[model samples]
Target: MSNPGSYPLPDRFDAVLAEQDAEGYRCRFAPVALSDLPDRDVLVEVRYSSLNYKDALAVTGRGKIIRQSPMVLGIDLAGRVVSSGSSRFRPGDAVVVTGQGLSETEWGGYSPWQRVRAESLIPLPPAFSLAQAMGIGTAGVTAMLSVMALERYGLAPTPRPMVVTGAGGGVGSMAVALLARLGYPVAAVTGRAALHDYLTQLGARQVLDRSALAQASPALGNERWAGGIDSVGGKTLAYLLAHTAAHGAVAACGLAGGADLPVTVFPFILRSVGLLGISSSSTPAAAQTQVWRRLARDLPASVVDSISRVEPLSRIFELAEEILAGGVRGRIILDVRA
Candidate 1:
């Protein structure tokens, strides 16, 4: 492993840069001068970056994920700080960066080197390697946040299963694994039958077909799940809300399926069900620290390793397309070292 500030520093490095114009948008792997990075308080030598759904949208120009162009396209990264003007961090400190509008309004983690705001960086947990940290990425952070909501809201692990929608994807897989590892019975829902064994390996107690939960549920259906972590919004959220046990909470994260909630307020009013919205991006540093601590303690290393795979930076373009089309499974980490 390369120690912080030990590797010969490169004044320029390869990065996936996205640019947009009236004609359209284009993204390519190219060398970027270190001096050109957005001015910030800390400079990190990013070792690993991860491909998330947001990254896919930003890289493919399929969605408005990037607020500015000619920016890097990775939402999460783990590395060693090489230099810092901020007193909060120092050279050789292992760090992880996610959210904080990264790859959106700011340069992000798709490169071997990046300048990041000091406030957005967290000390990587001692238990995790840089690869493991990037494996967790923003998706895993979001999952941990969702589980934190459920636990903090007084929904403890019980015999009654918790439903995790979009179980084949990054966030969903992480959620299922984290929940199950914490003694919660997890019912993972996925559209791809091919990933049944994969989800099972991640600790899902049971796997449900996506269609089983996509149909509109009655205003107040039979309470099936004790709690729910929903990544696929729209109908799946509606179903989870309708079938959630009384007083149970549902943490809604992503809007992969659709955004509109085509359901009435019956679930809330009748069942006293609570819906908590999760935003991994823009999370306060204090909260992010708490979540990362919980993740370090609760998420087993085997589970994290089982749910992610590595891909070199060169394969990112095709990986982005697969992720956008819902064809990819698990997390994809990009090895940025060249």
Candidate 2:
């Protein structure tokens, strides 16, 4: 990558600007001045970003993701540090910024440049390109955090297969790959039958239909899995809790299905099952760095390449709708320069 400062620096640049008014949330491409960016310790010349489900919601007004008016609408960005007031970073250093209230309290990656707190930046791994870092993005980071949490609870590869719910989505897909890459047998659950082959290709030893899981599961009936990673909350999570083996752990990340957990205490009291909740948004910098290091070691290049696709920023509007409807798969990397 060329030094960004080499070009005649423009006072303004292109950005996907969002604002909330009486008419509701609206977003579009617009020229925003450098001064319009958030007041922070570091300025990044963003090269790549990703379209996450939360970012989609923030961009489309489908969810209350951005509380402030005129916010940028991307949750993750990867690029070179243009400048930094803090000692942690300097010009030309590759870095990544995700979550940390992005697209909410702070201006985010949906621009040519972003000003963010130096504490929020993660030094990009040498093995990954800016696009590849965004390929992992927030969802992959969350998956890794869940994996770390599960391991913290002593979950490991064994004779019994681990189940990954919502296996077609970003976090679930990455979880399946990471678990399988670590030599664990994975049973992936998805509503879409079309993705069974895809999941298997990503390293799932078994592909179970979402409906079959419900039918086969009961209140403490057959403890099939050693442990599990669940993104779908509601009944799916409840089912996982009920069916996990005695002393087994389940890492619950997202509530894509629904927030309601209509479950009893049998899994906990009778089976000694553990439920670990994973929240990556506000994870401390040290922990974030730890997970990113783990990710660099665990998530192989082949798996990342298989699970991510690149698209230009112009396509985000349509991709957002597709992702919200659960029509998209894996990760979607945005080429901010394109």
Candidate 3:
């Protein structure tokens, strides 16, 4: 491996920065000085970052994902450590950072180089290359965490299918692929009918129309899924809960569809359904490591490639708009060096 000192570092690097303006928020590709980065334990030469729903929100100003202004707008990044103040990491060490207040309270991975808290870094597993790690990124981590949560709640592979809502999106795509790889049948739900083949190619046994589950469901409906991973909240989540089998669990992660859950406690009280809320942003580093390991072991590289595509960091604004409009099919890996 090449030492960090072997490569000449740039004084200024390109970054997608979001700044608060009178109109609200505006994102642009700006040159940021290396000295401007936060004083953290590690300085990473970020090679790749991945766009998630949260990133789209931050970049497009569609949601309040950034707690501070003039923030870098990427939630997931993978790269090599250029310098480290902590003993846990060394120069040239591969690392990945997802969440940990990134693009929120802290400067994030949209930059070609970023200073990150050492505790926020997970040594990249041997099973994945840096690009592949970002391909999985935050979306894959959330999916693995959701699967782990479901198992911890007593769910397992069974004849009954596990439904994944918003299946064309990053989190939902990862969830479907992970669940299917682990031997669970998956019913992939999406509003885009064109993604049927795409979802099936990712190992979904069934492709469900999102409209079927987007309606306000009864308090308790006929049990259908053994469980589910719902990235779309609101009516979609309500439907998933109402139809979940007894003692089954549904992991709720995102609110792309809406925020409110318009359903009674009948599903919980009557059928003992489990509602597991998955928040990857605040997950402990140790837990994040475990989730990444699980992803490396279970999620196929081909699936990752199929579900994600590489794009230059320069096009982030247009890409962010596309993602917010639900035009993006899956994960968008940003090549910071490009």
Each prediction's Cα RMSD? 1.8, 1.9, 1.6
Candidate 3 C-alpha RMSD relative to the actual structure:
1.6
lDDT of 3 by residue, 198-280 (tens): 99988999998999999979889998999999999999999999999999999999899999989889999999999999999
By TM-score, the better pick of 2 and 3 is: 3
Better structure of 1 and 3 per lDDT: 3
TM-score of each: 0.97, 0.96, 0.97
Candidate number with the higher lDDT (2 or 3): 3
lDDT of each: 0.89, 0.87, 0.91
The lDDT of model 1 is 0.89
Candidates ranked, most accurate by lDDT first: 3, 1, 2
Candidate 1 per-residue lDDT over residues 28-120, each given as its tens digit: 988899889999989898999999999998888888888887888888989999889899998889999878888889898988889999998
Candidate 3 Cα outliers beyond 4 Å, as residue runs? 1-7
Q: What does candidate 2's lDDT look like per residue over 268-317, in tens digits?
A: 99988999988887886677888889889999876888999999998889
Superposition TM-score, candidate 1 onto the true structure: 0.97
Best by lDDT, which number? 3
lDDT of 1 at 56: 90
In model 1, what lDDT does residue 107 have? Answer: 90
